[model samples]
Target: MLVIGTTEAAYMLGINCQRVRQLLAERRVKGAYKDGREWKIPLYKKMVDIIPGTRGPKGRWRHRLQARPTYIHVNKHIIDSNRNRRENQPVIKVDRAKHSKYCHEVEITGPCRVVYRPHQPLCSGAVLWIEVEQSTRVITKLYG
Candidate 1:
């Protein structure tokens, strides 16, 4: 019988090293025995079993939200300044059909108008709006 340490046994069984020691102490592993300080496990023996629970797949433990493109409206002055900036930030695309719902939601009025734009590094189920003013530019709260 090929013998291996607790760490190797844990790796073979897809479990923690401490769990392998625990299993040894509990006498769960058929051919596992303690030699001095180290626990030796037989390679061919049935050492461990996966416990049933609510965990999903290996990589997809949590669900991710879907993202969609958004549009925003800005003043001519602000738009001009943005164009002149060095960063070359993403320009707000004008999509009347897509942004109609969000346009009414922001309630565009006065000298300032509301526009919608999809956030950079797109987030799930939400979008950002850039509210440009004469002296300052502000990013509005995320809306889902």
Candidate 2:
């Protein structure tokens, strides 16, 4: 049986010399052994037998809950109001009991616009409003 040096084996296998030495050291290459400081590779039809494995450590979030917001709550309320002819009338009432279930109880200190659906009837004592005390900047990771 003929044998070849590390450099010749690396050239034939299309890999680097250090990698071939590593394969030899790990005993991954079949019929390959080390003699003194040099590695002797047996020249055969199929000599190299390096097994493939994961490159690095396993991920930590595979079976665990990832990072998420501390609080995530969404509430929606329907208003019931009467259709009366009035030139000027306050559409909103300060009745917090109707929407108490959906309220998160937060204070606002900045300018914000109130939004409501026109088709939906406003409740007799239903007040719905969302105020943002401060804007929050969120950075998200996008994966294709």
Candidate 3:
């Protein structure tokens, strides 16, 4: 029944004196009682268990467009124009209304180049252009 001060208890437990005071306030340390101006703890009693600190930031990680794979959005008018230009080309039609909150990743099997064009009066209202080599296949994946 050896009574020890908060600083001595903290030294024995390899923790800060403030942490010992906190444990005493929470009544987590066994056989520990508060005196007039200090906390007295038994030498044989164990300290409160320590919880592991969180590794990353405080909140959940946010999703960013640059972090994920690139995606392109094409409207119905663009698809119609592309179909008119190339008769034998296969056009993948994506519903703009249904996928308003999502982005589609277009994966081309062979050599391909993705071009982004800003809205201009001279050029057609197409924002994204995907140029693929001959005999290449394109696959589209949707992600919200």
Q: What tens-digit string does per-residue lDDT give for candidate 3 at 1-144?
A: 577787656544544678778767867677777789977777543332332335644422111111213233455654577578863333443222113222345566667676676753213355675555432434556543
Order the candidates by lDDT, highest first — what do you get? 3, 1, 2
Best lDDT goes to which candidate? 3
Ordered by TM-score, highest first, the candidates read 2, 1, 3
Q: Please identify model 2 stretches exceeding 4 Å from their true place.
A: 46-144
In model 1, the runs with Cα more than 4 Å from the true position are 45-144
Clash numbers, per candidate? 4, 6, 0
* TM-scores, each model vs. reference: 0.32, 0.33, 0.31
Q: Write the per-residue lDDT of candidate 1 for residues 30-142, one digit (tens) a residue.
A: 66778999877765433333322345554211111112223354334445765677433333333321232211123323244444556542222224443333212122332
For every candidate structure, what is the RMSD over all alpha carbons to the true structure, in angstroms? 20.2, 24.9, 23.1
lDDT of the structure predicted as candidate 3: 0.49
How does residue 139 of candidate 2 score in lDDT?
A: 18
Model 3: pairs clashing at backbone N, Cα or C within 3 Å: none
Determine which window of 10 residues in candidate 1 has minimal summed lDDT.
59-68
Instruction: Kindly state the number of residue pairs that clash in model 1.
Output: 4
- Give the clash count for model 3: 0
